[model samples]
Target: MQKILCFTALFASLVLTFLNTQSEAAIGANEIIRFSWRANTEPVTGYKLYYAEGAVTGPPFNGKNALQGNSPINVGNVTQTSLSGLDVHQNYSFALTAFNECSESAFTDVIIVYSVTISIHGNGTVGTYTSFWTENHGNETIHFFPSDGHFVSNVVVNGTSFGSTESITLNDVTEKKVIDVYFSPEKTVERDTSFPLWSGSFNENADVQGSIFIASDGVYVSQTTDTYTTNISKVSDGFCPKSGWNANYHLIQFIDVDNDGWLDIAGFGYNGLVVAYGIDGTNYHTAVNVISGNFGYNNGWRIDHHIREISDIDGDGVNDVWGFGYNGLVVAYGIDGTNYHKPKLALNSFGYNDGWEITDYRRFLDVDNDGYLDISGWKDGVNYVSLFNSANETYDNIVEWW
Candidate 1:
């Protein structure tokens, strides 16, 4: 025998805003909705929250008609509870009930609503006049504003290139969306379509075969034809997926790692991770994590470390990564196709620490005219050279240059 736990009063309302306009304002799919009510006058063990798809009208608002298998969840003896991970594509009706060991109370009035989440990326922000979470299908005006000295370059919605405008009104939003707003400097508001596009610290300055690859802030890469007049910018998802590669303090190097005549991008993250992006014709794809970490050399390799040089350390005709920084720390690895072999500890330390900081003087060349590339640099006012032995793959012959 089950007895109905009677409550003096029960109320349920959306934590955000309850809009009753011509167009129902829904909630964001990724948002958490909290429901709170007045405590029952009688003694009760706890409360259970039940939700089902579609607007449940009339009758008992109970878990029997809930969408998911795990409908009514026991939220313990609390007057308030929060729930998240709701599907925005569907309408939902929520019902609450109080229960004791022997009896359960009748569910409260049903609350029907809908939801969807919007994400923003790049150098601008998004502003929706209403709450990201809404109810009825209605037009949403999303405003995009750029930072100082920057203008909206492109507005990409769900990967489709939308017009570059100050704002975009999404007519009748019904699903999850991602908005990427790329910004360009005010000076370059109008694109440069001249011959021999300007190359500086911003774009790629490498020659891939007869063509040159250009990069915009490391986020985009464009390729130029032999004539240097026609510039084609292509966006691919193969550039530095992991390793936290940023353009602020990171260094980018373009080289033919596979020796297939096509130049690839090898970016060194500030945290000692190497990310490589291969180029095919005008597109850059197949991003691979070349070096996971510094391999226990130094914590990080900054821009001044000069570790972006790609050379053949063992003279295998294949380019390798040679990096040196403060504390005489060195990190070297030989490239094998898109992957790299075990790191070759060419030189761990050069006697004194903090020596490489005296000057930006470091080189990975055949200093003594050896077949293999040697390491030569200044360590605390003293010039030293470490000759590489190709046979054993080590740097042994250490000498001082007075």
Candidate 2:
């Protein structure tokens, strides 16, 4: 059952003076925001919902304000529509435009909406979310467990550290709360006669779309780790299906585009495409090529070094992705509004060009508590490290081993 929050009377009329129109309120939730408008005298096909982060004043629709989150609520001549995939506590300005058979009407006056629903985000192998009980504005408890081969690294709420507690009771949920629990995969590596414990903090960054991408022998996409055994598919079904996705799905990354409470999954496969699966909080979803084999000439960009949730490089509220390629090309994967893992060149030490002396491991630290991921790596036989200055976007070699 969907929780309705937009209208106080189940149909609060929004007074729109354009040709004298009124609309019902919007439903705000962890994953969706519903909006409704009264029917018009003229015949129309559907309504288009446009939203942006802040308030916008326009004569021609966004005269000075930049808008985002594009959707044409196509419910077939219905007055009601819900905009899904939204984050908690974010302010969104929405505007409605009617579309007929051929053309779209000018944007109507904007409506301001806020997401008061609490969101719980869990990362790592087969992530899942379960709301104990909807109190709307009271104490809430969040619990998590690592998979068979994984362990919980840390739990955070609204950017505050919540430590290693598997379950946490949020004291007051007056505002929309975002709880992110990160997990790291652990494996025992044989050092010689014995196997010592080796654990890493990977997949620590956050998402609200709650999507998990699993790439072991094959790629699996699921909303929770629990149904992974059941929801796993090879053809991608509705998500992006590639010719060889059934084969070399090596690395998987979870990202939340559009700031929605759910996370989307990015797959680094041997087929040379960074395919991403955007979960719609349900089974229906699609995976697209973030980078295809035709992209970057298929550089054979195998990911090295277990990626940790390094400190947020910028103050954008999301952790920046730092990836080291097999070719010594350091790349950063960013998400578009649609949640695609688009890689940007962060740095290139050209380790692959230098006799293919591979750089195996890398780590990130602020050192001085700055908002940048300082680079540290073990290449060839060198234990060198670099410092990141976010202001200049350059890495100063603090230590270089020859």
Candidate 3:
């Protein structure tokens, strides 16, 4: 019986020793911190790592507090063996538990990691005489010149850098003066190019309310008011469809249609005569049969709509007659030596409200230099000009006159 009792005590001691050893060998605090543990006898199917800022202590830890406990927030589930997002420049506490149907391992050692954010700015300028630099994103530099085309200096922007040499010559300017700044990651680089992105000029003496006519030779100019002497004569035979013996038209120009240097007078009339008088020194000699059997007629009426005086409609060398009739129809006719070509109709639609009567039509001028000539006129108390591109045949709604 004594021997049996001794054996029983030994067996109990051995079992207790084995249990203690297993518990001791369970995931160590250091191993947990490094996430270096493999599947143990307990079969760690997953893991739960808990971390908090500040120091930790004790086995079944108690009385231990987190530095950032007041703002405790979950960093979220991560499958990786190691994790991050701990407060930089500060200590942190951590623990790991092998999660499965059975039980978890021990707590882990504390760790610390560091992190930060930053920003930067830069700029510069260039020109003949004056130069400046700025951190401001203005990114544009302006160099001005006096009327004599002399460079004006003394330019500066606050909180900026200007190179050592200050003086520059105005004669170094291009026809279309412009300086461009190229931006780099660290500094702004300036480059001067020949073409100016934007350019314009204002003429104080420009004739706005006038007729712009292009002659057969393609010379264009505006005639503001009548510069003619009217010589009225009664016609005994009725020449026009409408019964009127008082038909007369005024001469508006003398164009050298053949470019022979000598000018010819072009006359306007109301069912009367369109005589071309050749210049003979100071006096003029009438050209014979210059109007016989010609379809040219003044129509005996004037409509206040915008009239398109004669010009090259098809871009052909010869000048074609273009005008807006009283009925709001745009008419174009080719002019030969004896007769006029059939009128090509444009914008002809019945009951189509034009909003305002046609006032005039003129050759396109690309005011914006967008390579399109814009037509300008008055409509409904507003004068507007639309731009048309000859190359693309596209029209832009940029009106400007009124």
- lDDT of the candidates, in the order given: 0.53, 0.43, 0.31
For model 1 the TM-score comes to 0.41
lDDT of 2 at 171: 56
TM-score of 3: 0.28
Residue 274's C-alpha lDDT in candidate 2?
A: 50
- Which candidate number has the best lDDT? 1
Q: What are the per-residue Cα lDDT tens digits for candidate 2 across 1-402?
A: 543222112112333211101111122232444456777546665665566653444423321122223443345667776544444345456666666655666666666543332333333332232222122334544456666666554456677554344567755333345566665444322111111111222134433112233333333333233333332233243212333333222444444433444444445555433534333332224566544442222345433332322124544555444444443435444444443354555555534443334335666656555766576667667766677766686777447744
Q: Which scores higher on TM-score, 1 or 2?
A: 1
Q: How does candidate 1 score on lDDT?
A: 0.53
Instruction: Show the lowest summed lDDT stretch of 10 residues, model 3.
Output: 11-20
lDDT score, residue 33, model 3? 17
After superposition, candidate 1 runs with Cα above 4 Å error: 1-231, 237-245, 270-276, 295-298, 327-329, 350-352, 378-382
Worst 10 residues of 2 by lDDT: 16-25
Q: Give the per-residue lDDT digits (tens) of candidate 3, residues 86-109.
A: 222233444444444444445444
lDDT of 1 by residue, 1-402 (tens): 556465544443323233321111233433455677777777788887887765775444443422223577788998887666555445567777777776677767666655433444445555544333334546767676777765565566676544345677766544445556665544321222221133322213332223333333223332323333232333333323233434445566666666655556665654444544444433456455666666222445566443456666566777666665444535555656566765544576552354455245667778767566777777567777777777786777568866
Native-to-model Cα distance after best TM-score fit, residue 244 in candidate 3, in Å? 8.7
Ranking by TM-score: 1, 2, 3
